[model samples]
Target: MQWIECRVHTTHAAHELIAQLFITHGANGTVLEDSRGKDFTPEPWTDIIGKPKTEHLPTDGVVVKAYFPDDGTLEATLSAVKKDLVQLEVTTNQPVAQTEILLTTVHEEDWAEAWKAYYKPVQVSETMSIVPTWESYEKRREDEHVITMDPGMAFGTGTHETTLLCLQALEHIVNDGDTVIDVGTGSGILSIAAAKLGAKAVHAVDLDPLAVQVAKENSEANNVSERITIEQRDLLSESSNEQKADIVVANLLAHLVIALAPDIHRHLKVGGKLVVSGIIKQKEQEVIDVLKQENFQIDDVLEQKDWVAIRCRLTEVGGE
Candidate 1:
């Protein structure tokens, strides 16, 4: 099988939108490349650290690459994707600076394994590490947790700041025997991490069938299939009594998070934690406002590389 790889260069603000456009137009998966390194400075830490130093990484643009099967419809799909992206810029009135699109053909086998060259083990938190299936990583500590994943055509490998922020929040909140619901559990990384952290049951849900399949395979690879259940479902839309959870973590777009705030709050047990990520710094307050309206109280906030993750809890009232 052959695949057409489409790479789009655009501003960081437009990266997520562009990726969504590709997925909507039939791309299986997307990869983001931003030369800017992540800098996480919790609000409380700023006083102690005297303001963390920021790196002078590239700020010009980011590159987003996606793959589509080289079927006869490839051209049409790419054209549609481009059109959607252009419309997005027009709708937002913000230019996708340095916009460029490049296409290349790659064999299935080659494309499948090409990412491995750059997908080495990544330590997202103090005790959690993401290890690609093809890589060898030695644990440096006794209590470290390793999540083995291939990602394949799924959406996460724990390298993105959004994912890292969620993982960091999960590390502090997930307790033994607690039930966890991972909305949009791409690559099943969060589900696996929760299981490793002693969650008795982890339900991972995604709307994409390919993501569900890859997440299931990753859970099995990490020996957490028994604890983590991967399913194809929208965000808590069909949640029932059986789906109520102690911790609900969602690493999704800011707009989606805001839209699902009420549903997310409804699915959580009273006083349960809600960890949300994939929000840009500019949109952080918008999401927070929605969460507040949904009766959730902000507990903690994590920021990295202009992305923000928030940890909030369902309160009995507004104070509890």
Candidate 2:
């Protein structure tokens, strides 16, 4: 019951990518910290304004921590992580900024219990507040939506900007009895959010089997399993039961968003909405150009730190 906490200190250039790399190597929990100190405002995202801010926070870069097994594969896993970090530049076609990696040994219970100390309820939007499964939260507003989740080994806890933006967008657009298809539905956060926001049925898909299972579990925990269908599949794959949806959400890397652009109409009804996130601000224009070519009209854009989540609508069912 021990783990190695791998901390990567790097600029905003590829912070999320580095954290995702840790998850790919079987890391259990990921914590990303970027000191936006004096500018910290949880407004619209959280109601805890009196919350104390950390002192001496790093101003030079972001610190991303993830838990990996201290088992015999440490050397091999660490080596592979390093190699992947090096190739990030080629992967994103953007130069990887300077980075520093730190390691520490921690008992499983110590870090697992750490969530209570740091992870608090976040009001992702005017209607939704993401509460940890263990925390007992009383709604501050009658119309607020509360989503309780454990995340397990999957991502999207609503703490990340990409997920928060998507949750917020869903609050404004998802109508009662609407059908939603969530691509790259990690941890089933978006699917769960869409269901909670009144979507009648949801199709959540992920290439990672673990993500698929965790998402299914999350849907059940949220009491929305009856409304969600979890599957292990790639993006936009043709399924015998495939049906068009009123909304499609893909919180994946920017490059993947570009690749998904051309085929989006196949699964989305005309005038259906597409919510895309996990995009760094630098790649915003690149993604938008691709979507435009496919006849998508931008509707709204939300930003947090170096990340952005965009909501666009399809003007035509088929490509331009």
Provide TM-scores for the models.
Answer: 0.89, 0.87
lDDT of 1 by residue, 117-166 (tens): 45667666878777778777788689989888775643545667788788
TM-score (C-alpha) between model 2 and the true structure: 0.87
Report the number of backbone clashes for model 1.
Answer: 0
lDDT of the structure predicted as candidate 1: 0.80
- Scored by TM-score, the top model is 1
* Model 2 error, position 198 (Å): 0.7
Model 2 regions more than 4 Å off? 23-29, 44-46, 49-57, 87-100, 153-156, 238-241, 317-320
Error of 2 at 293 (Å): 0.8
For each candidate in the order shown, give its overall lDDT on alpha carbons.
0.80, 0.80
**Model 2: clashing residue pairs?**
none
Model 1, which residues run further than 4 Å from truth? 37-59, 97-100, 154-156, 239-241, 317-320
Candidate 2: tens digits of C-alpha lDDT, residues 1-320:
77787877776767777877887887765776776643676754467523434553577667787877678888898898888887987878875546556789987567556555656676777888778888787888788778888755335356677887888888889999999999988789899999999999999888777678888888888899999998888777753336889999999989889998888888998999999998999999999888988999999888887789889999964564
